[model samples]
Target: MAEPQIKDQRGWAPVDTGYLDNPKMLDVLDASGTAALMHLASVLYCAQHLTDGHIAPGIARRKVGGTKDDDRLLIDAGMWHEPGHDCPTCEQPEPNKVYVHDFLQHNRTAAKAKRASERASKAAKERWERQRAEQDTPTDATRMPDALHPAMLGDDSSNAEREKERKREGGGSRRTPSRPLPESWTPSPSHIEKCSKERIDLDHEAEKFRNNALAKDMRYANWDRAFTNWLSRDWVKRTSAGLDPMKDW
Candidate 1:
């Protein structure tokens, strides 16, 4: 397949553009990057699947592998071909430059970006759930594992085993476990204290609402009688009067 010219296309700038400092710009740029990668992926899919045409000169024809390989290429374009050859079309002459840009690179970067996103999201969710659970279940009186605790060392064996299993299954052959966050980069004790104070303030607000007149009236009111009367009389009358019984609350 003819390599698409990397002309002055809009939004093809490198990832570290200054505009990305803004969250909106970051998202827009990332989305554009993803789109470009996807377009590259489609081109690669064609290269590997459709019969190889001349790349303006010398080169072996490309062929797509099995469905699994295809899927891998689709998910992670970086995994597609072993590092070899010059760009097929431009014939850039350098071995690294001779390579085809397709689904593999695009998909690999996309997968990395997506995985990072999911990991951050999972961490945030876990933190939120922990906070909520702690409302009913207090933290252990004993000190929990600090970042440097001995239990952290024990976790290494489990992580190693998982890595081995991943390689065995060929799922994570290229994946490396992420490094721990630096203490300076992570939330500090003072941050934790501030968050705790904020949580206490929120809980106090909820308690105040619970003690408010409206809340007291609603909680102490004849809920059962109201529900029973609605169910036995109002609901029955509504149903008999040709209202949809299923919808009548």
Candidate 2:
């Protein structure tokens, strides 16, 4: 023989056989009436119809595999309540409304759906905030590199960085000795002769002066002018002024 047919339903529903312990219910209702009440309870989970714990009489009877007679039995016993309110989610007016009494109290499925919707909404908001934050935030690439910033435009350290970049690109430790002196300072071989007398290698000294000035980030419109002035002072101090003949002429 075929196994006893199971009741048709959707998703999940809760049933508490514990109510069977009620003395009046156990003694008064037959099995068919009890079964009808349970069927309608599950049907109330359908938000499209039995929303908010109410069900249309025809749907309840049809799905319950009972009749209007079965429903009347439940109503007389105060087991069912009619549509008096709308579901927040479904929004059915009274004409289209059917509600289950205490739908929230016993329907775990509806409660679960509500919680899930709330969680989904919250997650979407957080994701949007994170994305917006990432967009508004800036990156290191947006800043000008220290090497490219003009010496006078930013800070004292910028000039030093600029000089280091020049050295890296042009090579360090040795600089060209033939660089021309600044026109305004007046150039002559006399500075070289004076340095030679002092036992200094003029070319090497000149190279060192240029490199040291650059490393210290000495700023001038013409570095050549500054360097020539420096050499002129040292040359004048070191060279003799005609052997200091004194008392005579």
Cα miss at 99, model 2 (Å)? 4.2
lDDT per residue for candidate 2 within 1-249, as digits (tens), equals 122223223345555677655543453256466445544444543543224454556656555577666655554554554444333543232453344545556555555666766787799999999999998876756543422312234445646544554464346542543233343443247666666676555665566555555555454444544445555543323323332112111
Per-residue lDDT of 74 in model 2: 55
Q: Total clashing residue pairs per candidate?
A: 13, 5
Give lDDT per model, in order.
0.36, 0.49
- Candidate 1 weakest lDDT stretch, 10 residues: 51-60
Deviation in angstroms for 216 in model 1?
Answer: 25
Top TM-score model: 2
80-99: candidate 1 lDDT, tens digit per residue:
23334344422222332223
**Superposed model 2: Cα runs more than 4 Å off:** 1-13, 22-50, 83-93, 96-99, 108-112, 118-249
